[model samples]
Target: MIPVLFLSTVLIWGTTWLAIALQAGPVPVLVSVFYRFALAGILFLFILAVTGRLRLPKREHQVWLVAQALCLFSLNFICFYHAVHYIPSGLESLIFSLSTIFNALNARIFYGERISGKVILASLLGISGLVLLFGRDILDADASGTLTGVGLAMLGTLFFSLGNMVSRRNSREGISPVFANAWAMSYGAIVLMLLIILTGTPLIAPPDATYLGALLYLAAIGSIVGFSTYLILVARIGSARAAYATVLFPIIALGLSTVFEGYVWHWTGFVGLGLALLGNIVIFAPSRRPRRTAPIAKDAETVASS
Candidate 1:
């Protein structure tokens, strides 16, 4: 099941950037985002409701849910959608690969986890990789588009990291990820709707088959199925292990970009990808601890139970 879920999520998400690119004509970014989440939210809610698995949040938990919706569903995606306009989808995915680093830092800050040397090293490696990956682009005077896209991708990854922290909170509070996600996605759609209304963005229907197909793929497979499986993987294997999938996403996205989008690659690009993946490996490697003496066994159980 783990393998199945992992592969499914990777395939679905690896292809989603192209779907998002296909959605880029005539319709506004916000509107396209709204459509994807709205359909997904509604369908997911209905499915959960029918299965008798829906869980309502308490007043206190509702606040966290709203925050999760904002970070995960609304703002992060908006940044990504706008970002794809300025850069290749593969490049955007490469930037998003930094989410693993961001997640660890946020965990340190929010949960008081000790900042490990590996985390610091991972950050530096990832940054160096980005510099090497965009080697000439960084020096080019006319590279505003790439720079801006990288900035947006970083901002979006930050939002995603924060959302992971929020999800951990929900998980700790005995809320199911699927339940929280279904509700949060619905809340996310409403938020996007309100933003559209406030900004007075023109509402438009899908203008062609490409737009409609992309919308369905994104709403159903990308948002609904992809997120559900990924979160479930987080629950089962722990986040550190589950993040292994994310390390491969950029690789697959790059393959697609090379084939479909005619993206060019160089030696620096290969080296940069190696460095970045190595950073993720270092960051997610299981921590080593001294074996506990027999005397501490009961105390360990007590702490875990408490």
Candidate 2:
């Protein structure tokens, strides 16, 4: 189940960036995001209804759920899609790899989880690699747009990290990840819809086939299925571990970008890739000590009988 969830996240997110890339022209970024989650929310709600799995949460949980949706479903994509126009998609993905670092820090902040030395060192390595990765571009070019892109990417990552924290909290409260994800998505869709209307952004109608295809991919595969699995992974594996998928999935996105978008890499990019992998290892490496098991006690059984 773990491996399957990991691979599913990688594949779905890997390809979805290309779909986002497709929406770049003739539409407001918010409109693109609005269309995506609105459709995705509807699809998820429909699936829940058909499967009889959708249940409304208690009133008290609504606020956190909405915040999760705004962070993950709305702002995360808004920042990312806009960022890519400034930074190369590969560089954006690399920036996104920092999400694991952000998630670890957020876990510390929200849950009082101890920050491991290994995790901090890993974050430094990853940041250094990113410096190397963007060395030429940053040094040679004005980089006004690119720097802005990097900033927005980081902002998007922060929102994603916050969402992870919320999901983790909800999980601890015994809420199913799916239930949390479903409601959050609905809230996000509503927010996006309001943004679209207020902005008066005219939605672009692509070729009938292409637009529909992109919508379906983003809505069903990318948003609903991919996000649901990711939430489950966060609940099960700890957000720090599950966020490793962000690091791996971008490799897939970078590959696709190279082939389809003619993204050429320099020596620095390879070095950055190595460092990113190392950082991922550091962040997720298991502790050395084995967990102790309780010894079976015969007296405990006697007490139970009594």
Best by TM-score: 2
Q: Which stretches of candidate 2 lie over 4 Å from their true place?
A: 125-142, 290-306
Q: For candidate 2, lDDT tens digit of each residue in 227-284?
A: 8889899988878778878877766776787899777899988998788778767866
**Candidate 1, which ten residues in sequence have the lowest lDDT sum?**
134-143
Candidate 2 global CA lDDT score? 0.80
lDDT scores of the candidates, listed in order: 0.80, 0.80
Q: Which residue pairs clash in candidate 2?
A: none
RMSD values, in order shown: 5.9, 5.1
What C-alpha lDDT does candidate 1 achieve relative to the native structure? 0.80
TM-score, one value per model: 0.82, 0.86
Give the lowest summed-lDDT range of ten residues in model 2: 133-142
- True lDDT of residue 301, candidate 2: 79
